[model samples]
Target: MSHRHVAAIDAGTGSGRCVIYDLTGVAVGSAQEEWTHSAVEGVPGGLDFDTRQNGALIDRVVAAAIRDAGLGATDIGAVSTTSMREGFVLYDANGEALWACPNIDGRARVQAERLTQAGISEDVFRIAGDWVSLTAPARYHWLKEFRPDILERARYMGMLSDWMATRLTRTFFTNPSVGSSSALFDLNTRQWSDHLFERCGLDRAIAPQVVEAGTLIGHVTPESASRSGLAVGTPVIAGGADTQLALLGLGRKAGQATLVGGSFWQMTVLTDYPLVDPSRAPRTLCHARPGEWMTEGIGFLSGYALRWVRDAYFEPILSAAGSDLEAFDLIEAMASAAPIGAMGVVATTGAPMQSDNWRQPPLGFIGFDGNTPEHALGNLARAVMETGAFLANSHLQKLEELTHQRYDTIQFAGGSARGALWPQIVADVTGREIEVPVEKETTALGCAMLAAVGAGMLDSIDAAFAAMASPIERHINPDPERNKLYRDIQNNWADVTMAASRMAECDLFEPIWQPPGAKFTSMTDIRKV
Candidate 1:
């Protein structure tokens, strides 16, 4: 077969990226453009984005990447897309988007709670193989209750990746990996659940057609080709959700687990059968490949927490570098200098799991005295990194228990993997070897491999990945002493998080610092007013 380049577009939460890669998975060119996500004015916890605007940005990046590659439209053999899962767009009969909501939007929490009250969470989990979520189904529930008019007017609903594929291929479809995340799909049947639609008061007609990932949906239309700088008949392959695509991109097989550390942290294990112990809170979804499932556990606000530390504490470094790219160097250097255990400071990075009954735990810090110590900054940085490690380790341990197999090594991907200290911290804390790939954007690379499959350049997804697999750049081994130190700290963090969660349950915290036995009258009176 002749060698050719394929293009992959990733519509992520913060930005849209178009990357061009050859058969061997070497990036020829890449371009990314950011988009805005804002809260809806009248709807609390509603996050929305413009569908058409995002499509335009995707086209712009595709054009830019082609230019950077110095290749003509016909040089690209095929195109594929992957995107943030769970978010969807409501379309009218004419295929015009009425509204769009992102995964982070929690406007449907109340609706989801209603389902939980009705006591169908277990049945929902049985069918979907996932925890009850305030995602697609709950969004439909919200619309049915509050905006029945829009519900009646809408003809079709599809995930964000489906919409992007339609923009390029002029076909409306979604893959099982994307569909399963919507909380409206039956994992066993790999189709939209009729009972779920009935529960959410939705019409089954509104659901998009289901297709397998890497299947050829359609060729790029003339209009889209002109906009995106691609050949009119370029094959547009169906791609799965970003998380699943990342797994394929990292060349993960059934025996392995992967941790994708982005804005949110995710740990997924590839298994032949769906890992469906309702006791395990991890979400089980179909993999991009047939007859395989990914058991996924998610930690919100992981890498973002580190970004918070950067902007909050590393102002001088940010000023010197004038951008986040260079500021990370200083942060990593400082974190490297800090001793293990973050000097007894425990940074509780992720909140407790579903049973907490409270809102997200406050980002807490413990064991800090009033005065700033000499290693204060390093301690703070290391603590933040350690928290992320502990959170990942917690999920990894759970995954091992559920699957009855231990993972000696984990493939680490996402932007955060570019940082040096964080991966080692995770290795030491998790007591597992960490493998970092040469390419950081495994999600896009995964899409490119699927594109290769659709283009007939590779016989199968496995073949495509084997041909284009990137080499591992680093292998981080756990330090024995540090691992032991972190074991105690990880246990302590659980206690600390539980205590903070309990404190949050009681929202009344008096400022009086005296012991119960000491006199509190003076301090209480002074602070009461």
Candidate 2:
């Protein structure tokens, strides 16, 4: 018997993927394409996205998925898309994009500093539930400061997924789940804050109409259908941000914390109301489900570091195998053979940083005794894994302190959770049980679930999730002995991190060096050392 299917587009930091799934949560066809942001000369952390090019690629990938599925456009019930949060595109009145900024774009650091200095940081945190990072506020600030002409001509500002939905369906709508990441969103009122727009020197009218997830934005236009091989009248679902969508895919509920182990690590807990605590500093945002909230601590550099180490160091050794799975296997084998505590080496992932503070923790190892490359590789892998664990535990503690809630189980997903050792490490370090679900592409599954809901195939998101979510595949329980060892390690790591922060605060390494014959007046001079 032929089964019904839905298409989902997942646009991530480095790549875009389209997957078609059956109603039983089984992936029937899939395709992926890697896309990169163009680099600008002499601009540190500057990246530009071209939506026209990206939209075309999205069409191609979605068409490819339909072809691979061996189904016609009429067979697919609906289409939905999810993307990385924070990155946005500015459009003119004609709906043509002027400039696009991804989440990685950091050209607005100067403006961000300006806001911090002007005491706008506290106000933003109170209203938006987050500190000023490289998101909309800073991007808008940069546009107002450097490119005022473009700012003057701007008619629409939207997150990347919202822009995609508009291109496909000719409707401009953004869900509160993605809006939660924008510094302009008001946490209390669940709407755009006029005060934030005034402070950022942007007009609130530039923002799109806010909607909830699972809402039918519009039907695919004929032009889009021709380009994407989707039905002309296919219902387009308003999917939310990638992280929250993944949580929805997991069928998450209140009282559960989810660890999305991707290139960036986020430990998020679902809540019934907005919980804003500057002391905790975890991001508080609206959940994909209406009337729910999510608080998270993110590690921006954890899994990316592991991927870098693998590609730079281990890939060559396993190049003959021509399989990433084999390389990961070797990495896991080496790490498992290494002595506990990585032979007295500690590597930090440089995450959970405070933007308001000037001092940042250094990213790397503190203790290394010139070990062999293999030993170092093993230790490096262990360090990377431990860094994720440390960050997760830190966030868990912060959430517990702020909400007075105890989280004993962490539902895990994303690319990093594929291996057995990493999950074990996380369980051991966090001292919590790790539950792994059957689906590997949780984000894609989430979009598909939303599509089903929008197409009337499912009554609601909860109903869709209950119908499609597969059973838990594996469970990792913490080892008592390893948990004790991790506690001590965490304490020591804390002490070293404090020392580093203090050193940075004092600018200890910035003193000028005195050359020979130069006058050195004090013993604290670099020449004295």
Candidate 3:
């Protein structure tokens, strides 16, 4: 049979998914399996990616997707892969996996602190458009300090997506979208920096060759084909980080902005040129497209926080409904009953993006009284949702200042966008129109677009997007009155969050979240920057 479809394998933070898409960008079949990274015993903030088990999971999903699509392996024309950024796998000289970790792994806190204290972090931000927090160098240093054997055996390193491609084709190559997250790439050149390797005491030889997204890397090997239910010699194309490709899938263009609200909320704005922030507050990342870049402001744990509220506080409703989708609808209705400001509830859960000095105070709610209507579960849930929007607004303003451009419309995607209330809140808070696409699995759709391009079914990425991108499902316009009120509420929330952060700094309360090796003595220290 002739090759008639393309496949995208996504290794996300929370799950592994395989989606098959036809030429029209419509998903024909998909399979997903949730997985978790295990915390390392006795290692503070350490999470290990079990490569052996996860690799099996990937194989299972790929085979299941093909079966679900009711198609033979020969029908898939090309395959591309995307994954959560900042997580990587190391390989030995013989290409055997040595060690792997996910993005949430923070075992290198001591090493990251040392780098920051030594002022090396500034140099890293200047060259790599990233900081030492959760980047590859600190992790590599940690391995060198604590697990020297793995470092000595490590001969090659690549991001999770690259590792997936390597599994199929036995070729190791990284694309800029994911490779740049390692804090080893020179933003100007979109390649590994020798200075960074030498300064961080890492072997430059371990870095893999960089490739642009959609570039054909290699063909699937017979061994992998047997295991993955893929045809031998099927073309394997280089893919990108999930967020970057998600932008492409949403049909975002240069000079546009998007808010990806998933486990984390990322406010990203694409630019034609790589623009580094002098303060290094926002992260700069390479776009999937060559010669393009993006500035990203992250809201940490926003989605996870929402999930926690549902599971912890709304369990009765969830259990009665018997499905998250239905239960969330009921929750949204209850939240709607709360006023625009969620009855003065200030939630300091998800922290706004601050790459230079990343940390968060204890997760809790302020401005609530016991058993009152204001302290109701509905209002509290709404506050958590509003906190996400508030953080996005802060990031958006910073992006506008850095890029010298105002975005009138914002594209919202990911799990949070599936709901009606959150998108409207984002539109109201940002004072911008929100466009939600019909497709929920945008990252997978974007990867499929790349696969289509790599297989020669589409002329270019732009062409693929034009041919395959989903239509806008709805356009949310900001309510002028609510937008004005949100501006004031957002300011109050910031002050409340800062106060909590100061409390965490003084050890009055433990920090709910802190980047690996981040140590802040006072909130004033960050403000002075």
Q: Going through the candidates in order, what is the number of backbone clashes in each?
A: 0, 0, 1
Error of 3 at 107 (Å): 1.1
RMSD of each: 6.9, 6.2, 2.2
Model 1: runs farther than 4 Å from truth?
1-3, 315-317, 320-325, 352-359, 364-367, 370-374, 507-529
- The whole-model C-alpha lDDT of candidate 1 against the native structure comes to 0.78
lDDT of residue 122 for candidate 3: 79
Off by over 4 Å in 2: 1-3, 320-325, 353-355, 358-363, 496-529
Cα-based lDDT at residue 457, candidate 2? 88
In candidate 2, what are the lDDT values of residues 1-529, reduced to their tens digit?
Answer: 2338999998888787799999878889988888888876666556788787888889889999999989899999988888888888888898878888776676776777677677776778888887776568777877787789998999988788787787788787788888878878997777888999897677889988888899999999998888889988888999989888999999897788999987778888888889887662577888888888888877765677787777877898778668656777888888887766787677744544343442345556767786676698898888778877787787787777787988889988988888888889999988899999888569889889999998898888888888888678999999999998888887776666556544543666321111111111212110100
TM-score-better candidate, 2 vs 3: 3
Global lDDT of each model?
0.78, 0.78, 0.88
Error of 2 at 472 (Å): 0.7
List residue ranges in candidate 3 displaced over 4 A.
320-325, 370-375, 517-521, 524-529
Question: How would you encode candidate 1's per-residue C-alpha lDDT over 344-454 as one tens digit per residue?
Answer: 787755642331131344566777663266678888888888877777887787788888899998989998899889999899988899999999789999999999998
Per-model TM values vs. the true structure? 0.90, 0.91, 0.95
Q: Which consecutive 10 residues in model 2 have the weakest lDDT in total?
A: 511-520
